[model samples]
Target: MVQADACDGDADRMTIREAIREGLREEMQRDEYVMLYGQDERDGESFEVTAGLHDEFGDRRVRNTPISEAAQVGAAVGAAATGLRPVVELSFSDFIGVCFDQIMNQVGKTRYMFGGESEVPLVLRATEGGTLGAAAQHSGTVHTLVSHLPGIKVVAPATPAASKGLIKESVRSDDPVMFFENKAIYGERGEVRTGDRTVPLGEASVERAGDDVTVVATQRLFGEAMAVADDLAGTAELEVIDPRSLYPLDAETILDSVAKTGRLVVADESPMSYGFHAEVMARVIEDGFFSLDAPPQRVGVADTPVPFAPDLEAEVLPSAPDVERAVHRVL
Candidate 1:
């Protein structure tokens, strides 16, 4: 984890929503070309993350778009290709299918198809994950699907600090970037640096350092694993890492931790079948195979769709106890 002293006492306590808004406000102030648009963003009705942005930036740069996801993404692609840096939100990550063609074909492939002469400086922001009774349609963690695409970058920030920093970096990136914010953590609070502080993409934050086992998690699971680490402090020392950028994964940090611990356990809110957990385990085994004392374990939701019922959702989702059990299994 980044220490408070690193900020030189220029940090303020803010929720994930406020942190992201602050980052967007700072970037828009720094670059005149940075513009934000999405459903209900102008009125700050959609998740309230873009609240007050429209008031500050005016309609030109922070206008609301129509309900059509395809039109919003398609327009953002065209705008980016011309000159503007557009940050378009899709309301929910599950709605990605509505504009997958535009994202995969146009946003992800425009630069390569244009012989590297053109740039798509676009950021697609979406709220993801379950546990809010949003059901399967509105509560899917689809970063794994987007990460599979070649040309786009995937980022999932777990904390307020990371959310602010990653948003700034995504707007500044020349390539198309997919920013997946966990809907459940929108109101979670943490201390974020007040000034211009950006956490680079493709980097992992080691929230807790230990030597017995390594536990890699993302989004909500990152916080769960941290709590599990604290509960098992003396019993089993687990090194917890948050892979902020899923596509350009910080495999080196995970590999080094595994090399030291000789055991691995990956936890994610996504399904277990061919998902982020599998990718992390694959990378560790392929690169750090000899550093294993036991078979690595994975903790995630079942292969079924997320249920709307709270009881069923709790049963399907991976919890802190699940992470603790996985650590015990690896040990």
Candidate 2:
């Protein structure tokens, strides 16, 4: 059930991190069964979003676990299957490696394996993507890897409003969800409702509507796409789409947009090969081939691991210029 409440409309002015904190706080308060726990360094992890949560929610509701990702996630799965909504905070998306067995073989496969006998209502929150000099070990956009797993949902929200709504929805979902939050978007602000206003699963929002090309993007790349759209407004018409949720993707919405524009471009910060951008392009080509006027285009990071150098990193990742060029080329 949606909370059906609204915020001051000032939430749009806050950062993504702030929005996440508010969402968690509100949800935990709204649902007595909701529990929060995860790995934290020194305290509530590197971002400090949950710094004081434990103090308010108490140890029973807000817990700080050991550095074992597998154990923590497994415990979350167990808790959820037993009738609690667990929010597992993964310190970083890369650390999911330590818990792959639990996530892929266990949490992701539980419901189906049990013949729908149980539902794992859990959200794995992690800081993902390149920025803030997090280096190779810490910086990674591994959503595609997780999105490939069955029985789990993957979502990336780039703005405050989306961050809040998406998290609320994920918490309420019966399926396990991997919620990727960009470290760079932590401080970005947007409007958010005070109560449960979910953005729903598998739906894409058209951030900017146009007729030339539909630039499907999400996360930080969504921002870049919008900027690129504005930059190229005088030259060509552009539509910016944010597929807020990756798994359970709303292919029809995207296809409808592309069908209207007769052109397509997918932009994502994840590496190009077999990544989110490529996946979206594949979807368009497979399901909406007749709607395209030109070949679908993609703008994303190179297929190599992220490097530490800022300049080299910029070259590897997608940018506004890159998205602009891809959209124009498709047009």
Candidate 3:
């Protein structure tokens, strides 16, 4: 029996928490096979993203597992292969290391190794990024490394609206998807279209338009890029694009934007060394190097562990000014 009601089919503003709750609730109601579990998912999740889901779906559907990352992933994979859709939350992206074996060898390569006999239609949601005083061990934007793995789709949504839509789509997809929620902007509010809303994976959304420089950002930095571009409106026309899905990258959109703009800048929260910004920079170089007027620029976190102090953390992480500087460099 369906416990939680579906979306009301009306557009309304909501926090990221409310939006994600609606998405998980809607998906659970739409498919009886869909189940959600994590550390504290049943008793108001640590981040409160899945708050109250247990009450609506009951204990059998919303479970809280032991703090065993490998066990959680292995169980989710087994359940998915047996005709069940399980959404597992790893709490934080940094904890991905605990289940790397399962994710890399078992879940990631199951379908290919089995000759397409089984599908791991599991959605793993994890809180990502620093800036909340969550120091080194607790914070990470690990999508850069995770995206390198085959058979796993990486998704990072910018706003509440995109969060609701993309998460709903991720739950319904027939492949394993790693969904990262930026922990810093969880309380930010936005308009979310109700009733079966979805933003397809691998599509890039141009947040702002310009003719001189293109700024492509991921995760929470996507909005920061938009704001920085707005600040530079009078000086230079800046176009901001959010490539929501990192793995099946929207290369065409970014390439076209670079072609028209003649310059590119990537702003990401990850470190500069082999980071998410490096991935975007490499893409532009490989496909549209000839279109560039100046050297491509990247704004990313410093190569160091995130500090607990706010001031020290600010020094390492990329900010609006850093993005502005990078944009100026390519211009």
Top candidate (TM-score): 1
Question: Candidate 2's residue-wise lDDT over 1-331, tens digit each?
Answer: 1212355553346778888888888888999889888876226677987777787888888888887999999999999999999998897888999999999999899999999999999999988888667778787889999999989999998778888888888999999999999887787766675555778877777777788898888788888888888888878888888888889887888888888999998888888888887788788889899998999888888878888888877777777888878876876
Best-to-worst order by TM-score is: 1, 3, 2
Query: Please, what is the whole-model Cα lDDT of each candidate in the order they appear?
Result: 0.91, 0.83, 0.86
Give the best candidate by lDDT.
1
- C-alpha TM-scores of all predictions: 0.97, 0.94, 0.95
For model 2, the run of ten residues with the poorest summed lDDT? 1-10
How much RMSD separates candidate 1 from the native structure?
Answer: 1.4
Model 2 residue pairs with clashes: 7-194, 11-190, 12-190, 12-191, 14-189, 15-188
Model 2 clashes, total count: 6
Give me the displacement of residue 318 in model 2, in angstroms: 1.5
Off by over 4 Å in 3: 1-10
How well is each residue in 1-331 modelled by candidate 3, as lDDT tens digits?
Answer: 0111233568889988788889989999999999997998898678988888899999999999999999999999999999999999999889999999999988789999999999999999888898888888887778887788999999988878778988899999888999988888899887887678787888877877789998888877887888887888889998888888887888889889899999988888887898777888788899899988998888887888788888998888888888888887776
